[model samples]
Target: MSILITGATGLLGRAIYAQCQAQFPTLDIIGTGFSRAQAPLVQLDLNDAAAVRAFFAKYQPSVVIHAAAERKPDVCENDPEQTLALNVETSRLLAELCHEQQSRLFFISTDYVFDGKNAPYAENATPNPLNFYGKSKMMAEQAIVAINPSHTIIRVPVLYGEVEYLAESAVTVIAQQIQQNPQSSHDHWAVRYPTHVADVAQTIADLIALPAAQSAGIFHVSDSQAMTKYDMACVIAAALGQNASSLVAVPEPTQSAARPYNCALKDTRLKQLGIVHSRKFDVAIQQIITRS
Candidate 1:
């Protein structure tokens, strides 16, 4: 079987591509990035409809994992048109192509779709996005479902993992800040279940192995443990053998785009599939630090 992965140069996409190659050695895998001319990733801009159509025609992949998006909430809020073009329009195009090719499209979504009012959101939770980024993703999900009900949608929380670049993951960004200035402060209000990208990749592989009867619809791939940014910073500091005592806890600051206060997702469906093996927050953080 052939698989096509978009945003292959990104954190989660890269991890998914690597894990798929390692686990399914005989499978044909094609990765695409916007401008990256890397060996494994071809330069294909999803915004270009003609180019994307040509790519799908050439590859005719059995599975298409749509992982590219304008993820920054503030940036999306600032440029709603661009956000819609990149997040929603690209996804719609890919969904149409995948449907024509009879390929399973795995769209990577985010937990930000939930309104922070609820604690742990389930797969069936109603999405009330507070920011344009989340709204775009929700629209994409709806479009994909309308086009192809058998497609898979995986919603993940804040992700941190082994990155090609040091500052790619938010966890590593925090580590860099702590290293620069041990006396740093972080938001104590916003809560998130920071999941490892490797775990997300493994979940994708497992889903692929499952029968079509089992692997359709939305699945949450989040860590069970939820913590505040302050808590995450402390964990990073501790893992790096730095003094977290110097870190101060501050209230969540206002942003151009409002973020969910507690967008922790519950992986009930994934657990039901018997494929949920999320690593502990501390353990994952330590591993990332050690690897860095």
Candidate 2:
């Protein structure tokens, strides 16, 4: 079987692709990236409809993991047009093509779909996005489900893991701040579930290996650890042998893009499937920081 992975060079995509390679060694795993595509990953612009169609026809990947999207809330807020095109339109196109090709699609979504007023959102929970990034992802989720209800959709919260750079991940950036300035102030208002990318990757691989009867529909894959930027900084500070008390905590929402106070995703579906892959943030993050 051939599997296709989009955004293969990204923080989460890289982990997903790696997991697929390790778990399904015999299957053909084709990866795609835009600006950073290298050998084993073809440079394909998802927006080019003709090109995307041609590539799909050539590869005919039996399973398609649609992970490419504009994930930054502030960036999406600033350029709604680009966000819609990349996050919504491209996803819609992928769903259509996957249906035509008889390929099962696994669309990546976000916990940001909820307004943050609600905690531990269910797989079928109603979406009330507070920002463009979340709205675009919610739109993509709807379009994918409309085209094919059997297709799987996985929604995760903020992710961190092995990264090419420290600043590449929202969680790892805390370490950067701690390294740069001991007195840096971090947001203590918003609560987040900073999941490890490797865990999310393993969950996807497990889902793909499931029987056809149990593989379809939406699934939430997230860590249970609830933390804020300040909390993360404290952990990161401990890892770096720095003083956690040196950092300042701002007890209010920060950042240009609106963030949810606590969009904790309830992974009841995955749990029911006996698919569990989680690590303590304090433990896993220390390894991540050490590697970086």
Candidate 3:
């Protein structure tokens, strides 16, 4: 069986690709990104339906993990058209193709789908996104479900792990800032579960390995531990052996798009499926630092 991964150059996509290769060595894997043309990965703009269709026809994958999106909330808010094209339209096209081809689809969603009014959202919670990015993802999720209910939807929160790009993740960005200036401070308002990307990848692999009848629902994969950006920054600083005392904790600043203050998710579904294996924030941070 062949599996195709979109946004392969991204932090989560890269980790998933690596883990799929490592754990399922005999599985055929194809990865696509915007401009990167590395081995096992080709450049394919998901926005172009013709390109996507051609690639799908060529590969004829039995599974497609859709991970490409306009992830930045501000960018999505400012450019709603681009966001719709990438996040919604592309997803619709992929869903239709997957349905036609009888391919199982795995969509990586975010905890931002839920409003911050409720903390530790469950897998079955209704989504009320606060920003265009989140709304776009919610729309995609709905479209995927409507098009093919058998698809797997995995929602994750604030992922951080080893990456080819050091500044790709918020955790690494905070670490870089602290390395540059120890007195750097960050927002303490929004609480998030900084899940490790490796954990998310493993969860996807495990889901793929499961029987089809048992793996076709929404699942939340996140660390049980939640922390604010400030707490995360302090942990990252401490991991780097830098004194975190000087790191300031300030209120969240205003932005173009509204951010959910409590977007932490509870992986009850994953736990029930015996697939929840998230690392603590501090331990994950240390692993990232060590790898770096």
Q: Please give the ranking of all candidate structures by lDDT, highest first, separated by commas.
A: 2, 1, 3
Alpha carbon lDDT of each predicted model = 0.88, 0.93, 0.87
Clashing residue pairs, candidate 2?
A: none
Best by lDDT: 2
* TM per prediction: 0.96, 0.99, 0.96
The C-alpha RMSD in Å for every predicted model, in order, reads 1.3, 0.8, 1.3
Off by over 4 Å in 1: none
Off by over 4 Å in 3: none
Predicted candidate 3 versus true structure: per-residue lDDT over 1-292, tens digit per residue: 9989999899999989988898889989888898765775899988888989999999999989998887989999999999999999999999999999999999999998988898878888899999998999999999999998889999988888886655888768898888888999788888887888889999999999998768897998888777888898889888999899999998875677899989878888777887867667787778878787
- Model 2: how far residue 102 lies from native, Å: 0.9
**lDDT at 254, model 3:** 60
Best-matching candidate per TM-score:
2
Clashing pairs in 1: none
RMSD of 3: 1.3
lDDT of 1: 0.88
